[model samples]
Target: MELTRLKKKLVTAVKGHKLLKDKRDELMRQFLDLVRENMALRQKVEAGILSANKNFVIAKAGMSEQILNTALMSPKQEVYLEAGKKNVMSVDIPVFETKTRTADANDVYSYGFAFTSGDLDGAVKSLADILPDMLRLAEVEKSCQLMASEIEKTRRRVNALEHVIIPETQQNIKYITMKLDENERSTQIRLMKVKDMMLEEAHHYKEKEVMVE
Candidate 1:
């Protein structure tokens, strides 16, 4: 009976150890995936930032030139911004579209310039041109944040399984296995002693029968 109990305990411990190992492996996979995603997003964010900077420089130079030229020509113009929404990776970014109008209070100064004559136009155009970059940056930033959060959560889970939960379960399994082993040894010793006593008694009976004969 004791041997039977030990066998059952050993089986249970082996099963529990396998389950804990599987859980640890699964958590590690999840954590690795999140890390990969975070690295990709970071790369994209860097590229987008560089592109945004280049666009800003070009836009600044163009606007400066346009401002000087417009001032010299003394042309009057009005510009308005109409912005629309652009969705990138579930993040909505504003894309400003420009509308320019030229109005002459009197015919003293005739407006003979392109829609891209003024600083405001240049600024608006620059903004519109960089809208895609802005959107990319937003998407990358948000994705990075989300990935980082998920990675942290996954890491914690992995740590718990690897360091605390799995180890505790394995320790318990070891303890149970040891107990079962000890019980089995004790039972085997008891059985051997019982068999030896039975053999001695049988020999004594044979001796008595011989003496009577």
Candidate 2:
């Protein structure tokens, strides 16, 4: 007893469902990519941290043996940070690159000591100490990039479901319901007419028989 309008609405809803499914697939693909990137960045950060720890231990040992702090210490030098913006899936994150002089307080060496033997080792070790932090920054930046991309993607999907997909489905349902109602009404009217015609014919037959008799 479905009406034409209702049938058309069902067809529309099917089309909308297909479209939403495609959108969901695309969002999932993007999400997976971001997750992979995040994992890789995390591994890199962990490695950097391990390396930095090793460097710190070596530096501490060297400093203890040399007693070079008073004689080798130099004035603090400026460290400049230059950050660049990167966009991943419409998420902007700042990636910092450091520009600093190689010279450090520990870089100065006594005349008799080899250039790479004592304080220079300490300077290199200090750089290693900062390496972990630098890697951490990198990790944070990558994570932010990944998260932002995912958020935007999720937002779009949610919007599509709420505003477009769900509404379209409901619209189709409404149309189909109306069509079915109209069809039912028409069917009932036709059935009533048929019933009335059958009754009238029966009455005529009975009158004819009675007259003949």
> Every model's Cα RMSD, please?
10.6, 7.8
Best of the candidates, TM-score: 1
lDDT of 2 by residue, 1-213 (tens): 444555566566567656656655665565566567667766765775566557556656665545445434543444567767766444465667765466454432333344334434545555555554665457565755565566666567667756786677677767877777999999999999999999999999999999999
Per-residue lDDT, model 2, residue 107, is 35
Worst 10 residues of 1 by lDDT: 104-113
Please list all clashing residue pairs in model 2, or write none if there are none: 3-179, 3-180, 6-176
Per-model lDDT: 0.56, 0.61
Residue 53 lDDT, candidate 2, scale 0-100: 57
Indicate the residue-level lDDT of 49 in model 2. Answer: 58
What's the C-alpha lDDT at position 147 in model 1?
42
Instruction: Return the TM-score for each candidate structure.
Output: 0.51, 0.47
Give the range where candidate 2 is weakest over 10 consecutive residues by summed lDDT: 107-116
lDDT of 1: 0.56
